[model samples]
Every structure is written in C-alpha cells, then in structure tokens.
Target: MSDKLGITPACFTKLVQDLRIHTTLTDSRFIQLEQKVGFLLQALRHSDGVRKVGHRFQHSTSTIAMYIHEVVEAIMTSKLYGIYVHQPTPDEPTSGIITRNPKLQPYFGHCIGALDGTHNVFAVCSFDLLFLHLHAGSEGSAHDQKVLAWAIEKGFQIPGPVKYYLGDAGYTMSENIMVPYRGVRYHLREWIAGARSSSRETLPSTKQELFNLRHAQLRNVVERIFGVVQRKFSILTGSAPEYNYKMQAMIPLLCAFLHNHVHINDPFNRSTGKARAARMTMEAKRARLEIIYKRTEEALQNPAVAVDEEVDDPPEDQPEGLSMEATRNEISDRMWIDYLKYKDGPRRRQQVPDHLDELLLAFDHEGLLLR
Candidate 1:
C-alpha cells in the first residue's frame, strides 16, 4: 500500500485517522473519508488536475474538486502549524554548526530561523481574473519584501529581542530583521570560491566581507528548506491546480505543514535503530555545546568584557530613523576585531609538522602553492 501511494503505509493510515478524528468528514453518500483523502494526496503528490483525479477515482471532475477543497480545508484547520512550527526562545542555548564555530555563535546567537519568500504560479480563470482586477488589482507576482511588509501591516507578530530571521540582500534590514552587507560577496558560491583558494584568494579582506560570509552561511538554511519542500511535493514544483488565487496561496502552507508532519511522526524514521543513532548524534552535539557554553560563561564573567550602558528605543512612528545600518556597522566592527584576535591567537600559531612543512616547501618550489 505504501509503495502504491508513494507514502509509507503507516503514514497514510495515520493521516487518514487524523483527518477522521479532526475534520467533519464522515462516510458520505458517494465517497468515504479514505477515498477523499487519497484523491487529494494523489493530486498533491503527482500534480494531477481535477479531471485526472476524477478519472482515476471513477468520480466526476466537480466531485473531485469538491473533495480536494474539503481535504485542504480540513488540513489547514488542523493543529499542524501550531504543533510543528517552532521559534527558538531568546535565552535558548545555541546548537548545530553555530555552536561548533567559535566565530559565528556569539554574533548570531539571537537568530531563531531564516525567512524567505518563494513565488508559486497557478493558472487563472476568467472569474479569478475579474475578481482579482476588481478587489486587488491583477494579483500579479509580488516581491519578497512587499509580501513581508504586507504581513507586518496585517499585524503579524514579528519576533524580537534582536531575535530575527536572517534574510538576503533582497530584504530591507530592520530592528527585527538581519540582512547581509550590501555590495559585498554574499552568496555561498562566493564563499566557496574563497575557501577553495584561501592562500591565493584575498581572505575576507574587509569587515563587510567577513560579515557577509557569516551571514550567507546562516541564511542558507532557508534555501535548504525550500529545496526539501519542492522535492517532496510535486504540486509546488510543477504547475499547481487552477484554483482561485486564495486557494492557491493556501497550497504552499498546506504542503509545508504536511512536510513537517511527516518528518516528525513517521514511524519508519523513528525505529529503535534510528532512535539510537539520533541519541548518539545528540550526545555528541551535547558535548560540543557544553564546551561552547563554558567558554561563553567564562567570557561573560571576565571583567574585560564591556557592557553596554545605553538603551535607547527608537521612535516607532518614524520610518527613516529606524534603519538598522548603524547597528549592522557596529556589529561588523566587533566581528572584525574578534576575527583578528582569533587569527592571532596561540591556537592559530601552532608549530607545523616537519613532514608537512617539507611538503609545503616542495609545493612552493613547484609553483603549486597559492600566492
């Protein structure tokens, strides 16, 4: 059954059971809950149109469309979003690569998650066209910044205490948002090139370059999440259904919630062996995290660490004065100094092995050593 559906049998059964328990859908006169859920998942997993789904399920196209709407509404109204979406607390200890890297954790400890918008194109019928023209003026493509601004204007709770989402240069930096330095090598590819030719390439020569390198590394999580979603759900990568614009918008959110659900609850992924592996991973991570926390505590206890005495809240009504450029500059300067200290520290000045030094000298004579 799992092979047939492209989802594990347990997962499919769990989803059906969840819908039965949560939604108002019962055995209808024409269709049962299993058939309805199957129809919707087929369409989403395969990007099949209503006509195709109706033919496969032996139902009329309109019936298939109705069932899809019912399932989508049920999924959306469920508690998936609240259960799966997590925001890190301000005082939470840092983890993952951030904890492993001495240079980045202190600088970006307040970052919870990375945020970015993706464009999803759906077909538009004449009715949708007319409606969009009348109400919202064409429903054309929207930029990421514009969508963020609209979300803010609509009273979305922007997380804070300098806990912000990492955005790319496309976004405007604000009190609650952090972006890479403008007019600098900001992309992962640029950093990769620099790393591959570290001896030859000028290494993050300026403060802005170092900041952008670190920013790009952290912000890459958002891209990875997007890639995973697109790969998991063909509906997002392929052409979506010709639903109304509002319904189309809801599809991405529904897919995201479903992805999170499967990731968290899949039985096969949570077997005893996998559980052991996960435990081992966590233990190793915990060891690293302990070292980082101890170092951080020592640094905080040190009397040499300067504490900021001023706390000035900017005027909320004014837009111009709220720009985060000054704050970004200050952070860049501190990061630059921290990087210099790390480079000149005793750990970096360790004596090289005689064999390795000979090899390096040979490479230098052969013109293989980077300038």
Candidate 2:
C-alpha cells in the first residue's frame, strides 16, 4: 500500500468507500489500492487535496478520471427530478404551465425565465480555441448565447415556444422571448426607484415596481443555480482534459441538482445570500420608480381595463380538480377593461415616425386623462 499509490492506509480505505471509486483488480490489489486512491479522490473534491503526499505510493491519475464518471452518474440518476423551466405566455391558454399551477392560471404573473448562459475558464494544456469554444478546452469568457445553444443540443432545460423568455441584451432575442431593445433597461430599475421615491409606504407608482421587483427576485433561481454549480465543483472551473467535454457538462448539471436539493429538501442548508438582492444600476432604478408609480396609478383608476389571466387551459386528464367552468365563472365576475391600444409599439422607435413619439408632447397642453 505504501509503495503502490503513496496514500496513507486510512485514506486509501476511505477513498474506495466514501467516494465509490471503482477499481479493477484482485481483492488483495483492491484493498491495497484503496489506501491511497481513496484519499486522492477525497482531496480532489476538497480544497486542501494534493495528488502527491510525501510520495508514499504513486497515485494512478486515471483512477481519478474514472471517479468523475461514476459520481456524475450517481448525481443525475439519483438526485434530480422534474426539469424546471420558465413558462412562456400561453397562446391558446390551455397547455403546459396553465395546467400545472392553477393559482398562477389567473394572472400572467409567471411570464418569463431569464435566458442567458455563462461560462467558466479551464486551463488548456494541448487544446486551442476550437476545443475551448466547445467546452472541451475553454476559458471562462465563452459567450452565453453559444453556451445556450450547446445546452439545448445537450438536452439542457428548454421552455416551450408559447412562453417568452426575458433576457438582457447580451442574449440572443427572438419572437418567442423578449430581450430589452438596446438602450432600454429592465423593469427592476423601475422597482428600486419606486421604493426610494415614495414616503407614502406603498406609493401609487410603486405598485407595478413592486410586482416586477418580485418577478425579478423569483427569476433569480436560475442565477443561484449557476453559482452553486460552479462553486461546489472546482473541476468545472479547472483545466479540462482533451477528452472530457461530456463530463464537464454533466458535472454542472449534477451540482445544480445537489444545490437545489440542499436548499429545498435539506433543513440544515438555508439560503446563503442577502435578504434583499441589490439592484445593479441606480439611475435606471429611479426612472422606473417614477414610471411605475405613474402607470400603476393609471391602472388602478382605470375602470374599463380587466386585470385577469389572459387565458387558462384545463387538462383533459383529471379525476377531481378545479373545473374549467369554475375558473371562468370567477374571472367573469371581475371588471376588466381594454385600454392598451397604444401598447402596439412602433416598429423600431424611428419607424414609428415622428408623429407618435411627439404624441406625448402633443398631449402636454392637453393632459391625457385616464379613463
């Protein structure tokens, strides 16, 4: 044992048992090998781990390679269930999320999943940019859009087409999703401004800000999922082996399952974050607050506009659940108005022609009244 892998007897024993690293050999060799290889696997997963310790026994590096494959399989098959995805707005109103969460069926509150990809840098030994770009050998700076494409091909979580994904300008925007127009800011800024400007506690303009703010907070589930996956598995951020692209992707997916499990299932590990997430840009936040306050006040006072879920779809397969008729009856009881005629935005702010952008200016002398 001392000469074989240079691992302490106790460490070698633990490696085989704790990490479940499978080795091929006779019983005697297995026992002997465990003393060193076991310790190596432990170290690899931990911070203070080193491959060589006093050169006690020569550690076969291939053992560690096999170790990754086994662990990734265990994580995916045993830990994860129910792929979580962002719900898109229902076109016909009778599918997917509309059937899953009945409470959310009434309000279009669950609108988007922030779609953006991120990468981690790995040391490239023999590979070049081609290898790196595919994550076989890569740096942390690979673009998110590319990563997203890679993820989709690899069967990463993909929401259906009916719902729109919301993302920053860095992401590739499409008709199925909404990315901010260049120079336009997200709604979070508006929420922050609403909170800051109002002494009225719940300022009139602040309500929409508050709603949008909540949406942003909930959507950060994806971000936290990313952070935990990267932090827990340094192998992901470390150098990539030329042949290990598949392992790299699988490892992150497993880690995401673990993180979600620990937070949602384990009582011991709670959220390790600020109670309130800090907004990124303050200037934009203030402007949003003003806009939200103005818009919310307008919305509340408008009697014609109906604030209800646009559509709901009941599943055909059910024994005893809320009936579709029941849902519609409740919605019909509410007074909803249609007043967003102006929401049909001009294609390209420039294409809207000068007449529209100046329409607000036209109303300056004739204050536009809320119906």
Candidate 3:
C-alpha cells in the first residue's frame, strides 16, 4: 500500500478518520473519501496532468480536479495543522537526536532545529526530520533571510533566548538563529576530505573551522529533510505543470503533513519489539520528548555568559556583517578546546612515522592556506 501511495493502509485509514472529524469532507454518493484522498495522493505522487490522472482513475478530468481541490481545502483548513505541524514551545524538551549524539549534544544542546528556505517554503525542522513550522508560498527568487523575516512578521516564534536554530550562510546571524562563519570551509564534504587526507591531522586547526564544522553538521538536518521530501513527492522534483499558484504552494504543505504522519505511524520502520511502539497515539508522541540543558534566564543575564536577547531583529536596510561574531567566536573557542582535548588525548604519542608526519594543509579557492 505504501509503495504507490507513500503511506501504509493503516495510516491511510487514520488520515480518513482525522479528516472526518476535523474537516468538512464527507463521502458523497458518487465519490467516496477513499477515492477523493487517493486521487489527491496520486496527483502529488505522480505529478501527472489532471487528464492523465483522470484516465487512470476512470473519472472525468473535471471530476478529478474538483475532488483534488476539495481534499486540499479540507486538509489545509482543518484542525490537523495542530496535530501534524505543531510548533515547538520553549518549555518542550529537546529532541532525542540531539540529546543522544555526543558531538551535537554538547554544542547544540540548546539548538531546537534547523531552518532553511526551499521550494517556495520557509521551514523549521527538528533533528528528527519533522517539520515544526512552515511558511509556504514565497516567491522562488526571494532571498532566504528576507523570507525568514517575512515568516517572523507573520508570527513564527523562536523557541526561546537560549535555544537557536542552525542555518547556512545564506541566513544572517541573530540571537536565536546561528549561521556558519563565512570565508571558511563549512560543508560536510570539505571536512570529510580534510579528515581522510593522509597527513594524520584529524583536528580542526582553527576556531572558525571547528565552529563551521559543527554548524554544518547540525544544519544538515534541513538539507536531509529536503532531500527526503524531494524523493517522496515527484511534484517537487519535476517542473510543475502550470498549477494554480495557490495549488502549487499548498502541495508542499500537504507533503509536509504526510511526511510527519508517515514518520509517526509507519510500522515497517520499527523493530519487532518496537512495532507496537510505532503505533503510538498522537498525544504520546507529543509527550515523548528528550531532556534539555537547563540554561536559566539568570545564567543568560550573567555578564560572563554572553547571552543577548535584544539582538534578535536587526535593522531592515543595512549591511550587517556577522552580527553575532563575538557570540559565535566564543562558541568556537569553547568547542575547539573541548574538541582538542577529546581528539588529542593525554596518552597519545608525540612522534609519528615519516609518512604520517607530513604537514596537513588546507587552502581556499585561490590556493591560500586556511590558517
């Protein structure tokens, strides 16, 4: 059942139930809910012309078109938004993916998620690959940071002062949005090449490199979610076939809702002992959050803590370069100290073989060594 529709039979049934309760969609004498939702899913999965889909379903193109719009309206205007796309609150516990991973848990303990603008949607996604918040229907040519500002203006909330989202260089650094250090190697592939080189120098040579490495690692979640979404929904990968602007924008939001539903209810993704666990109730899933670092408001107010709550929204028209330079530098230096201690331990030997003792050097595009 999931092979063609991207959702299991059980998930499909649950979706129908939710729609029945929360939406005005009702089974008509001519077309049932099964056919309506199925047609909607097919349009999203196949991205074919309406006439082609109508032929496949043995219905008139007008019928298919009407059913698709009805389902879209039902889903978009329903109470399912709270169930599926619930925004993370300041008091909610951190994600387990961050709490369990050693590298991220230390640096990104207060990090709630990653933020990115993609496919005409600005999304904030958790490390677990669930979309926490989405602002869809932006122009494709709009700058990411500008779209983010628009999202904020439209009432997208940041979790809190201590918590932040990891973003790429395309976003500006704010108190609650940490972007990578510019003019440094920030991608995971670049770091991988540096690690695999034969020089045996595995540690980041500078604080900026270390910070960018961690930022890239944490921010890669949004990229991974986008990749998964693209693979699941063909409508996003191919050139859209002249959909109405509203329909084109709503497609991504529908995909995000289905993605979360599948993540929560797909039994094949669980182990034998955890198959029942995969069928968790929505309330239980909401309660299954992880522990977070208790960085208090008093701690933030301390002069030594370097936390700034007032630096969130910068002036709209200005060239602000690295607004949080001191904050990011402090984080990099602290992370570098800890990373150096862990990578180069006390019992490690000082001398190395001649082949391994060669200098490990990295250069920029112009061929200058990166410090």
Candidate 4:
C-alpha cells in the first residue's frame, strides 16, 4: 500500500491516526477516517479519478469527493503549518547544497529557502472562469511577478535583512529576495553548455555571469521542491482533478503542505540511506568541480575581472522602493570578490582533470548526469 501510495506505511498510519485524533469528523457519520485519508492519498498519488477512487473505497463518487474535501480542509486547519512551515531564525544552521560547496556558502549564506511559482492546470467551466477573473483575478494565467505583487500587497511577510529566499530572474531582487542578473545565462542548461563547449570563450565571461551561475545553483531548491511534489502527488502532474476553481487552487497548496510534512517526517530506510550517500558524493564532486574551475580561471589570468556595470532604476510598481537592478549589481560585485579570494587562497585536490570537464558538465539542470 505504501509503495502504491508513494508514502511509507508508517507515515500513512501516523497521518490517519493524527487525523482521527484531531479532525472534527465523527467516525459513525461517514466512512472511517483511515479509509477517507487513504482514499485521498490514493487519488493524489495515482491521479485515480473520483469514480475509480469511489469504486476502490466502496462508496459513491460524490461521497468520495465530499470526504476528500473534508479531509483536505481538516488537514489544512490542523497544526501542519506550525509543524512544517515555520520560518528559520537568523541563527539557524545551514545544510544541504549551500553547506556542501564553499563557493555557494558565502554567496548564499543568509538565504533561508528558494522562492518560485509554478502553474498547475486547473479544470474550470466557462462560468467559473469569469468568476476567477473577477474575484481571484488571475484566471489561472497570471504571471509569477504579478502573483508575488499581490501577495506583497496583501501583507505577505517578506523576509528581512539576512533572511531571504532565492528567486529567479522573473522576480525583483530586494533586501529579502535575491534574483538572478538579467540578460545573462541564468539557467543550468546554459551553464552546462558553456562548461562542456570546446571553446574556452563559452565559459562565464563576466562577474554578472558568474553571479548568475551561482544564483541559479542556489535558486534550484524551489525547483527541487516542485519536482518532489509532482513525483509524490501524481495528481499535480496530470490534468487537474475535475474540481471547481476554488478547490483546484487549494489542491496545490494542500499537496505542498503534505509534501513538506512527509519530507520532515520521512522515516529512514535503506533506500533513503543510499539516496543520501549518493547525494553527498555528488555534492563532493561538485565542490571539486568548483575548485577545478577556480584553478583554471586563475591559471588563465583573465583580465576582464569584476567590472561594475550601471543598473537601471526600479520600476514604479516595485515593492518598498526596492531597486532590483541595483541589488543585483551589489551582490554580483560581492560574489566576484569573494570568488577571486576563494580561488587564490587554497586549492583542493581535483577529482576530475581540467581536460575531462565534459564528464562534470554532462549533467542537466537537475544535476542528473547522463551516462
């Protein structure tokens, strides 16, 4: 059941037990809480249509839909947010990719998490589209920046000072948010191509280029979050469930919250141990690659170092008088200086030769290297 449902059996049992203890639903009125939760999980994990879920649960499709909605609402109203989504304090310890790479540590030392918005297809009737356009206002076609602006306007707590989330170029860089430098090779694909190319000319040529590369590296956390969410909840990857617009909006949010819950409470197993070991090995290789790149750059003695470029002023709609262009320039300058110092100070033993760079560059954006 856990294998089919994409969660550990213990996790499923714990979730059901928690919901039974906390939910307002009485066991006598509807199906058992365990079955309700199981049905929802199966539907989410397999994208099993409501009809199929109803058949599996031995209930009517409408009953299954109602119970699923109730379960989602109950979970949302529970302590999931408090348990999983708490903001990190300044003194919180750094881990994961940032800690593994020295180059990334100083550059993204203060970043708490990565921020990015992904669109999920929602099934909406023509009448509901009008309602969404007028009330929700995005009509499922809104830009990431626009959604961010709305959140800011609605008093969403933007990070302050040293605490921030790494965003992509679509967002405006601010005191609490960092974005990639505009008009640069920002994506991992572009960086991989440059790294693998025979021409040394294809490598990052300017301070901004280097900054963008690092920015993309750190900002990828959000992409990984999305990937895991989709992999765990196949309903998100498939066409949206036949729910109404409002319910459709809640689906992703619910899945995200559940995803975080599962991640935080994941029970260790042999597969998990193997995956962790592989990840650590990959991070070590990446650190070595960074060292090699630093050595190569230093050996080449490239004179076109860290030139400050003029950044345009912020647009009128920018929140809190934040100048994204100015923020990017300042951070880029800092990164350039830090990288130069890192390169000149100490050399780690290279894991791969400079001539065999393609072996390292064969990976795609997600760090999954091709054979």
Best by the TM-score measure: 3
Residue-wise C-alpha lDDT for candidate 1, range 1-371, written one tens digit per residue: 54334467778787777777766767789788889988887887888899988898899999999988988887777764545433444664445556565766667666655665544221101100000000121223565566566655644445656656666665667777777766677654344333323252345678998787677655554544544455556777677647887777777767665665566668453222222332324344334334433433454477543111111321132253255666668778999998778656787657221112111211111112110
In model 2, the runs with Cα more than 4 Å from the true position are 1-65, 73-113, 120-143, 156-158, 161-164, 172-176, 180-184, 187-215, 234-246, 261-267, 270-371
Model 3 bad stretches (over 4 Å):
267-327, 346-371
Residue 196 lDDT (model 3): 38
What value of lDDT does candidate 4 attain over all alpha carbons? Answer: 0.57
lDDT of 4 by residue, 1-371 (tens): 75677778777776676666666754646567778888788889998888999888789999888888888888767775445544455665565556676766766666666655545222111100010110122434555566666655644456555666666665565667767667776655455435544444654567988787767655554544555567778887676547777776677767755665566566452123433333335446556556545543553364432111122442233564265456567777887887556444546223322322323432223343110
Better of 2 and 4 by lDDT: 4
Least well predicted 10-residue stretch by lDDT in candidate 4: 125-134
Clashes of 1: 0
Model 1 / residue 119 / CA error / Å = 1.8
Model 4 backbone overlap count: 0
The lDDT of model 2 is 0.35
TM-score for each predicted model, relative to the true structure: 0.67, 0.41, 0.77, 0.73
| C-alpha lDDT (0 to 100) for residue 283 of candidate 1 | 40
Candidate 2 lDDT for residue 307 = 17
Better of 1 and 4 by TM-score: 4
The order by descending lDDT is: 3, 4, 1, 2
Error at 351, model 3, angstroms: 13
By TM-score, the better pick of 3 and 4 is 3
